[model samples]
Target: MKKDKNRYTVFEHEALYVHRGEQKLSDAQLKAFQLFYKERDFPYYSLVHNGIRFCEYVGVIKVGNLTIEVLPKADKSNGEEHWRSILIDMMRSTGLFHPDSPSYSSLKVKNSTILDMYLELFATEVERLMHQGLIKKYRKTQSNSTALKGKLLIGKQVTLNAVHQEHFYIEHTVYDKEHLLHQILSKALTTVVKIGTASHLISRYKRVLLDFPEQRDIKVNESLFDKIKYDRKSQSYQTAVDIAKIILLNFHPDLSQGSSHVLALMFDMNALWEKFVLRSLQRNAPDGLEVSGQVSKDFWTPETGYTKKIRPDIVIRKNNEAVAVLDTKWKNIGDANPSDDDLRQLYAYSRYHNNVPSYLVYPGNENKSLSGMYSRAFVGDAQTPGGVIKLKVHSGKRDGMELLNQNISAILF
Candidate 1:
């Protein structure tokens, strides 16, 4: 547990200042950040005069030896550790990273960063895989062999063996560990070795690499992971491969600058929050009720172009009929009203879904449900619609998911 002076921790929607002689950022590091910001469509942080202001995205950002961890916050009194744990829980709930919980003793020492958690999980999986034995696949290879093999190439044999009479050119299939899955895992292990700052995990990483077989490294990217298809033989590697994708895809190294790189493992809080609520509702919904998120329907279609779709965040149905529409917001609108855009969006959902009830859900101190209705002028109808538009908020001191279930039950059930 050595002290890392280069690490900085901040909450979401907070700023990490980097003025001259103010923050420890060097000129090269600043340029690296600038280039990273310009090259990618990263929406997690916005550039400020002194430094970067993190938005509603929470995770770790490593620039060379420097580590910046942005954590989620619901209340100002909550510290970084609280939000870090909550973030991990949310990710687990959404089936993102499947790591076992880190011990409480480690939290007290204040040594492990988010990146360390990822490396630990990845190394642990690799260890398990090594003990079980790495899977091998048959790959095609071509070369000049002393004896004839599977397929003899007449043209190559005549051209190359003309010089050496004892040689034979052939193409053959060899069953071994050199395959796509091994290549991906090997690349991820090397990535951990390169940028890892946690002292304890370095030895674990090296140990895993020692037993792992050599693999031909390919340029890892998002598409490479998408191209993978798992079968009965490779099903055991699903969890390890999922974790590997998170590690390799989020990593971006600055090649032009010396030893300066940027690795961001941030998740959009808005998207994560929406997904959390959707999962909770899906799991707890009663027998007859159906819960679906991002239910899209065609909104408009041109004569020649593609049709536009309108999706509601959450749609609730009972007995095969659309009953309610819910739009979850991560921001707290305590004692205040939701924005006009939010109301309008819900209104559109209600109108399109046969005027079923709509509600805007937010995070707050308690479930202070507000009820209202669309007026005649607003609805553009002869009489006002009976379907009510409401505001719902949920808060919990012990378990947020339980409170969320109670609030949703009270509203729809």
Candidate 2:
């Protein structure tokens, strides 16, 4: 089966080798090759497997002597449903089973294996397609037939009485009387002083001024008390003021301000970084893959009583397998590597979820190596290769997302 200089390997009754070189494949040569290898598992198999008419007429692949054709399988009676069931069953048997296995019971036994095998292959192709940015992949929703329904409210607005009740009426009055000396003085003071200062003065004098005459101030004993004047109240007030000043001065405003800013910025950066990570996950996941963002899991211990809850940034599921868990850390996870707290958290997630692999994704620092931790203890170093992964979000010259995609693809596929 030699047509050209390039050798095409065929896995058939015999492993036939063909040289397809300078000469282009003839129609008859392609048709013969397709018919011979139509049902076989190879790169060109998809052309024929898609349909018989497709192989014969649209010839996606060149076969020996005969061009491949694809024809749509007949959808009479329950043929389509039967085939779908068969595919599901086969997939289940081959370790790619959906958790909801009963859904495939209606599918035909004969078509199940073939369809399932094709689905497995399709999954791989879908992964490749997603990586190449040639196609968009979405996870199939569990409930395909469900539709959201909007409720319509048909009603009229009810009118209420506009009259205010005697008790309900709130009187907000502003009286301007330049002729009233006390009122004028109060207004002038309010206008001149800051709101805080005015409020303070009003509060201080509120108890003393029960009546207009009670506001009178008596003259101090000047000459008689001048010699033996003991200023007790003034001395106490001065001492209290000195103590208050010392307390205010002791307050470390800079430390508090710096911490507040750092926390705010960390959250802002984390939010942006998380979005990028989610996009990368969505882009790389295969069709029928479900991704959950910020999934929380709560664990309770006998000693601690619901010790803590962990929220992984991303949790990806394929064929109902809790495949990967990713945590995004915005902090500079220095070249020295993740702190003990980080390792404990990730390891707890893994241990809690039956040893699911966990990844700690951080901003790329050229100095750090993607390493693993080995201990459950939060303090000291324990072991090597504890199944923890430190994925650096690569630095400089290359696109971060591209690097992320590459790393994810390698890990997932």
- C-alpha lDDT of candidate 1 relative to the true structure: 0.76
Q: After superposition, how far is residue 41 of candidate 1 from its true place, in Å?
A: 3.5
Give each model a TM-score.
0.89, 0.31
Identify the runs in model 1 with alpha carbons over 4 angstroms from their true place: 1-3, 20-24, 99-113, 380-403
The numbered model that scores best in lDDT is: 1
CA-lDDT, candidates in order: 0.76, 0.38
Candidate 2 lands at a TM-score of 0.31
lDDT by residue (tens digit), candidate 1, 1-413: 34467877878897765554434566666666777888876787888775677899888898888888887776555666666667766766677766343322233212356677777666767777788899999999999999888899999999989989788899999999999999999998888778765567889888888889999879987789888999999877877787788888988876775477677888899899889878878888899899999999999999998999989899999887888888878887667777888888888887888878787877665556777778777666633233322223222255545666666666667
Indicate which candidate wins on TM-score. Answer: 1
Where is the poorest 10-residue window by lDDT in model 2? 258-267
**What is the C-alpha lDDT profile of model 2 across 37-92, one tens digit per residue?**
44333332333322222211111122212221121111223333332342233223
Model 2: CA > 4 A from native = 1-267, 287-289, 301-308, 366-400
